[model samples]
Target: MQTEKVTQHIINWLKNYALNARVNGFVVGVSGGVDSAVVSTLCAETGLEVLCLEMPIHQAASHVNRAQEHISQLKKRYKNVRDAKTDLTPVFEEFKTEVSLEGEQAIVDMALANTRARLRMTTLYYYAGLHKLLVAGTGNKVEDFGVGFYTKYGDGGVDLSPIADLMKSEVYKIGEYLKVPGSILKAAPTDGLFGDDRSDEDQIGASYPELEWAMQVYNEGKTEEDFTGRKQEVFKIYKRYNRANKHKMIPIPICEIPKNLK
Candidate 1:
């Protein structure tokens, strides 16, 4: 489907679900990237109350600034746009000390990255509870669902995902259709976990387009086709996340009792 139509469908779905569930509004984390921008726009179009949170750590100033600009534009365009900003440096530092993390810089950086994501989720859930809102997840199919690029209990945890099926390229198209700011639509997508030198694609070692193609092939049961020349690598990444994070995606296992006993 076209990106615009996909966005409209998502907006309608969220609106109906929110109304039926008696939710007061929708809360979304705005990371100054295309996916979140598109999700925020859809939430606004649904005529539901939308809250955008800018949670930035020490290395995310550029992303935070862009996010602020996007939020300002959203306020002008949408009637019920509310925003909040919080720096996550203190929270990350406290987490590091509490966890007693002594290791390589790469390990420390990854831990800090996950900490920032969890902190943002915590803030979103706190306000969602206080205001009776549903937290809107902003992960796209190519990232969170395909390769499990998000942190398990961090960005991966949410009340609902409005754009979990769309790929990264499709997200950019939706951003354009929504008339999101050009700068935001064109900006390089990043988690802003590390400094400017770090990026999602860089860390993953594969671009979203390639990943999406592989995902499509895999979903179609064409696992043997060597589309990207990294099929084994992709499979390994997918399997590792699926195995290590099974708890995140499934119900808690419990010992089964005999039916006769009940």
Candidate 2:
């Protein structure tokens, strides 16, 4: 898709939604990654107040710096770029001391990583309430609807997802079209939960392009026909995470008696 049309579509969509909800602006967690960079630019183009938050733990200095750089460039184009950083190390330490955390170090690390995501979400909501801004999710279709590579109530919790329909590669295309900083566009995508070297592809063992291809096939109602190589691997990833986190996507269950029983 052309950058101009996509940009206009996003602006029109947000404007209508903002007016309907009586919102004054939009807020997004800028991870210094491509997805959030594109989202921030799109939101800013709508002439809405776009607040970008950089919530980093101890391991995100490099990513945070890149995010700041992107935000700086965005400010030149959009007047509403503001940043706030909240370090989550102290909060994680306190929680670790309170709870008897058991399991391997990997498990502990995963828990800490999830804590950081939930903290970011909480901070976004707090600002949203204060500013009457809609929380814009930066997750793309490949991650959100395909592999489900997100926390249950962490980054997954959002008022709206602007790029939910675009794949990760498509998100990069949009970012390039919007003239996002080359430093951000070229940076290896990571969640900044572990060290700077850790990445989602490292954890999932699949590339975004491959994941999106499998997703498109599956969405078109195709079954797993090939049982070899990356195809099988992608299927396993899709099934495992989808089945494991099914509860995350559903509402809490409740038991009730029939009204006539009374």
> Candidate 2, residues 1-262: lDDT per residue as tens digits?
6767877788799878988998988998988899999998888887878888877767667787788999889888878777666766787678779886788988888887788788778988998998899999988887787777888679998999889988888889888889999988888777776755687888887778777777777767766665577797787777676667667666778778899996
Model 1 C-alpha lDDT per residue in residues 185-223, reported as the tens digit of each score: 767778876756366777777777767866776777765
- The residue pairs in collision within model 1 are none
Model 1: residues with Cα > 4 Å off, grouped in runs? 195-197, 224-262
Among these predictions, the greatest lDDT belongs to 2
Model 2 alpha-carbon drift over 4 Å, by segment: 250-257
What TM-score does candidate 1 reach? Answer: 0.88
TM-scores of all predicted structures? 0.88, 0.91
Question: Clash number for model 1?
Answer: 0
- State how far residue 19 of model 2 sits from its true place (Å): 2.0
Question: What clash count goes with each model?
Answer: 0, 0
The local distance difference test score of each candidate is: 0.80, 0.82
- Taking all chains together, the TM-score of candidate 2 against the true structure is 0.91
